[model samples]
Target: MNLARGSSDDSGSLLWGLGAIALYALISYGLDYRARARRGSRHPAREALHDLKDREEPQSPRHRIVSRVIMIGGGVLTGLVAYTTSGTLRAVAAGLTAVVAVTAWAYYDHRTETRDSAG
Candidate 1:
């Protein structure tokens, strides 16, 4: 499928992609709702909209490792999807962007950890 050309064949794939996204969103929402219910949160919408503050407890090293692994895996998956759907160039760009983002996040996390430990 040549995505560069506005071909009718692309429309079916686009619709399927959109449907998949919608289904995933719905499932995510349901899970969040269940979690909120379990927590006895009255204002689910407000809680969802609220920015995540730093946790009172520090994350364990294992947790940090798992989080980083998941982040990198997500990036790789995104790059692969872009490669299959768009092209090599787009995949390369996406992969690079993901790497930069992950690097920045890791640096920020390290700085925060050091600052917390010092003070």
Candidate 2:
């Protein structure tokens, strides 16, 4: 398969898969928002990693279940679409590139926010 272009048949699935990825991101963000509200913390992602002393209580069972479902199901489906569009190697490369780029961006933004708040 061409790296730069997708076949017509694959285009629709790719678009749909992209949409699923976006939805997963939005849902994850929304989960973070709810977690923030529960914890009364502005940076939920940082706090959610551990059971901080100030955390009000454990998240509800429903919230926890929904988070798992969205993460696993959405991720698997998006990955499947990517693999179907291209072969294994290309899909892995694309997925890694995306993950790395997003992680770097998030880290940079987090650092900036911390610096701004400190100063």
Query: Could you say which candidate leads in lDDT?
Result: 2
User: lDDT value for candidate 2?
Assistant: 0.51
Candidate 1 stretches with Cα past 4 Å from truth are 1-10, 49-119
Off by over 4 Å in 2: 1-7, 11-13, 16-20, 23-85
Task: List TM-scores for all candidates, in order.
Answer: 0.36, 0.40
Show how many residue pairs clash in every candidate, following the order shown.
0, 0
Lowest summed-lDDT stretch of 10 residues in model 1? Answer: 48-57
Global local distance difference test of model 1: 0.48
User: Clashing pairs in model 1?
Assistant: none
- Shift of residue 56 alpha carbon in model 1, Å: 10
Model 1, range 1-119, lDDT digits (tens) per residue?
Answer: 65554454444445443443343334334444554567799976455333122232344565455545654454554444443354455445545555554555455555655665776
Q: What's every prediction's RMSD, in angstroms? A: 10.3, 11.7
